[model samples]
Target: MIKNGEEKPTTNPVTAPYRYEISAEQCRSCDRCKKACKAGAIRGERGQAAYLIDEEK
Candidate 1:
């Protein structure tokens, strides 16, 4: 088969797993962000530094 002025479509390649981070100093630890995350990825005590677990997400 021959094509004239036609090209095939391309797809975006998959990239590395996404990494989430939170600033412990900046975080107020209000628990609002944790509550919003339905995936339960955020873990840590209230009024303390919170960590984001990639596996939990």
Candidate 2:
């Protein structure tokens, strides 16, 4: 396949059938993880139990 005006390799990358997730009930609302995320893919707020990761990222 062509990408960025360049041809890509014929090899296919491996992908997992499952994804990691943290339940809202399991979340303690700690800001540590959010702070550690440099890509800003993690969406959540401190003091709030709900959290989610952006699949696009």
Candidate 3:
């Protein structure tokens, strides 16, 4: 039975995946992750790079 305000435990393998947010200071404009990403969800501008969620995915 479940109780109110209780959370269910889950570890399903099919669940959505998450990405680690790299620090901006650490970014040397390497663009390695951008090239690595097949989804093309990364873009660089203004001397800084960021990961964007591509609608295609």
Candidate 4:
């Protein structure tokens, strides 16, 4: 209820799971962990990879 003018939602949007970064320097570029990430939060560039909870996730 709003005296001025407002709307309210009953539920919040579902957020994807969080991803923590693994040491890129230690990453072997095998992509094994990347394949294992069900959330598709793992991304790589130039042989160095990182895990992030981006919009794609």
Q: What C-alpha lDDT do the candidate models reach, one value each?
A: 0.69, 0.71, 0.63, 0.60
Q: CA shift at 48, candidate 3, in angstroms?
A: 4.7
The TM-score that candidate 4 achieves is: 0.44
Q: List the residue pairs that clash in candidate 2.
A: none
- Which residue segments of model 3 deviate by more than 4 Å? 1-12, 45-57
| 1-57 per-residue lDDT for model 3 (tens digits) | 343455865455566777656567677767787788787776775355644445545
**Per-residue lDDT for 1-57 in model 1, tens only?**
333456655444555766667886678878887888778887777877655555655
Q: How do the predictions measure up, each by TM-score? A: 0.52, 0.56, 0.48, 0.44
lDDT of 2 at 6: 55
Indicate the TM-score of model 2. Answer: 0.56
Of 1 and 3, the candidate ranking higher by TM-score = 1
Which 10 consecutive positions of candidate 2 have the poorest summed lDDT?
1-10
Best candidate per TM-score, number?
Answer: 2
Clashes (backbone N, CA, C under 3 Å), per candidate, total: 0, 0, 0, 0
lDDT of 4 by residue, 3-51 (tens): 3335554444556755476774677776776778787877665355544
Error of 2 at 54 (Å): 0.8
- The local lDDT score (0 to 100) that residue 32 gets in candidate 2 is 70
Model 1 steric clash total: 0
Tens-digit lDDT string for candidate 2 (2-43): 244456555435555445576777888787767887777788
